[model samples]
Target: MGEKQPNEQLATWFVRSGWSKGELARQVNRRARQIGASHISTDTSRVRRWLDGESPREPIPKILSDLFSERFGSLVTIEDLGLKAVPNLAPGSGVDLPWNGSQTVQLISDYSRSDLMLNRRGFLGTSLALTAGSALIEPMQRWLAPAPASGGLPTGALATARGGRPPTGRISPPELALLESTVRMFRQWDAQNGGGLRRKAVVGQLHEVCDLLQETYPADVTRRLFQTTAQLAHLAGWMSYDIGMHPSAQKYYVLALHAAKEAGDRPFGALILSDMCRQMIHLNRSSDALELVHLAQYGSRDTATARTSALMHALEARAYANLGEVNKCYRAARLAEDSFTDISVPLEQEPDWITFFSEAELNAENAHSYRDLSYHAGRSEVYALQAQPVMERAVELFAQDPDHQRSYALNLIGMSSVHLLQKQPEEAAASAQQALEIAIRIRSERVNTRVRKTTAAATDEFRGVAEVIELRDRVKQELPEYTRNQAV
Candidate 1:
């Protein structure tokens, strides 16, 4: 018989096995656990990867095949499972990498060691230019899709303190260092390059950190750690938005929001939701975005600091602008501005999470809102010019801080794109090149995509210019294969 086609054979097997994707994952995980592989967190994407001819790394394939064989009363080799060699899964592919359950556990166990290395001053350079493309963004987009409305709280709601121990009690100093270090690395990558490249690594790291924090830390520490992790996750999600990964980014943001809530940090939680709303606006789901912004504002009313409240209002203004609600946008923008009046006082007692939002940051946000409104009203020239200086200052102020990298990169990219639109090729190319350099250093797909878009736009303006052509070609060459595949 001829070799079975990939999709048909996989579909047939799925149908014949009387197993849903979730069931398969559960079975695989259960078997792996019985075999002492306790680190497995199997999900639908794992099954999807198998269907796509991607095999699990290490003993996972063997274990999974064995589990299936035992149940089916048939010999099921790795080949039968369509995994002879590990297929090159994309960044978000659900397949377990070389690390199986055991390895995962080991990695988490050794988190402290890694944390020490990561947190060392100036451990990683901050100049690598990363790229963000559709590949990164699409997954985030899917993840960020609006959750179905329900009366009760979500499944991942906070629970009472377990075992009469605090969630953060188990965290070692080294582990804390690791968390801070990773956050720093991600921030630097985001600022210099864009969110595209560093986002995946940040998310993965956040997940690992979250797992460790939950298992080992005491309550207060766990709460704080989770809040930080959630913030990183949300930033990753925002990068996902820049690269068009709406769904996956959405999921990360939602998860981050939940994490913030679990930390009893309502302000941070609201900030995350507001960030999600920003993504919704980018996706042109303006109405949905506005609703989310409102939800954030309402939820955060009690505890939100001036900076946080300003950010929420600014985000709401952006969404309103996107929807062409000029009056509403203006109102929100004015509120955002007013919120900033008290920013300095709050900064003295500011939480760690909102420390990045200073007066300059507030001004930048105001500029961003104006830019958005201007763009919507077809006054692009004025807004575009106004945005440039504000964003430039913002980037300059944030340059030294790794935590603000993603935001800086984003603003730079936006500023560069605007420059391109304004026919300022030299400025555009310079900004694009700087962003590209940052994107390369960071491991984010979304930042790369934004760079690509900026470069692509620049190409339109500088078609015959050698520098622009060279830059465009370089970006094209640097784009990840998966991104190129999606584009094709």
Candidate 2:
């Protein structure tokens, strides 16, 4: 109906495939017949139209995805090809369901399949929209629904939901152990390097895990498998978020939550919700983030450890801070510190996934809270002064761990923000320079964004100072498009 613009993404894939337009049309028509779309017909003109920005009906996109995947010897998605599916073929359209159902597999499988092409789709100049905070709340509600009067949801529940597969050929213990170790390995890599490096590997393993879920296993093995799957999905989601692929990250987090539910791991599900809340806050949906953090705390009330509780409380503080509620934020921050001090269990006995929430991590969250409050709470110097000591402590702790280069860099930016508000131009520029160096090394858009944002703040605070000018020049060289004119 509108002016026809070229679909360069599809054109690029077509050119890479090295096939004539006629060759593609013939393959589509042939694949259509093979798939029983006998009434369908495609000619070279149809292919040309698609390249000219016309979306073909169903079956064509699927066929092309399959064909290109084969030709490329890797997974290719409809999104990677830049083709919109007909309404009936849309992903997850009718499959949203309760956590402990066959639909879990479908949801994970569909999402992972699409995510395999996530890195490739960037060139398409489009992306899936982020799921709203309210949409994520519904899944949390389902997760928090009361468990059966029995100790837990019955093992038969999983079996029945899985459509009663035969019990033989259960997954071996060694394979399950390997899967778990792989998850831990991936988690560490994500914490060290940014998500951009190994996100695809995580997504690829997740796809295979979904296939394994299709087979019946011993009840204990089933739960373990689901736990492993959930952990992998969560790591994949976090990685995606680290690299700024928000929609994909949200999808992976939701899948992780459902898988955690199936595994009956309430504490882990709450963690996923909190992470989702963190993402929402980063996207400027702090109001929604507040709701999500509340849901997380309530849902995990009985199951969460002291450290996990502290983590949730810190996130609550972050939400309140972003909302400019200084009193509430400070109160929540104290609660976090108190919760940390009250840890009854030994650090080594806590869940491996959450053990990373050490004193340093808490300080990092607290510093961000204070930094945000400095701006929004209308007492810039006062709150920034409050942030300075904690921010410095976080940077010092993170500096001892070279693996957490990204976190180290980001905290430096936060420190720089504090200094800028305190009218310390030299200190702000120094911290900004340190963070920029790290941002240039790490494969994280988040860090780059932090660098740009800090540079923007320095630009506003110091104006034309030679030191600020030099920082601007370096930032412009590294991020050419984000000059002084851009507000970041």
Per-model TM-score on C-alpha atoms: 0.56, 0.77
Over 4 Å off in model 2, which ranges? 1-97, 123-126, 147-151, 154-157, 160-165, 479-488
Clashes of each: 69, 0
Q: Candidate 2, residues 1-488: lDDT per residue as tens digits?
A: 78989999999999999999999998877666544466779899999999999988876787787577546634456887898755444656322455553577768887777655533534111234444545556656777775544345423335634456566545677888889989888887777777777877888998998888777676677778788888988988888777655656777888888788778888998899899889878877788789988988998899999999999999999999989888999999999999999998988899889988988889999999998898786747888889999999999999898867888898999888888889887888999999888877666777787788778778977887888889988998985421111110
Please name the candidate that would achieve the greatest TM-score relative to the true structure.
Answer: 2
The 10-residue segment of model 1 with minimum total lDDT is: 122-131
TM-score of 1: 0.56
Q: Report the lDDT of model 1 for residue 61.
A: 65
lDDT scores in order:
0.59, 0.78
Q: How displaced is residue 89 in candidate 1, in Å?
A: 23
Candidate 2: deviation at residue 99, Å? 2.5
Report the lDDT of model 2 for residue 21. 94
> Residue 243 lDDT in model 1?
50
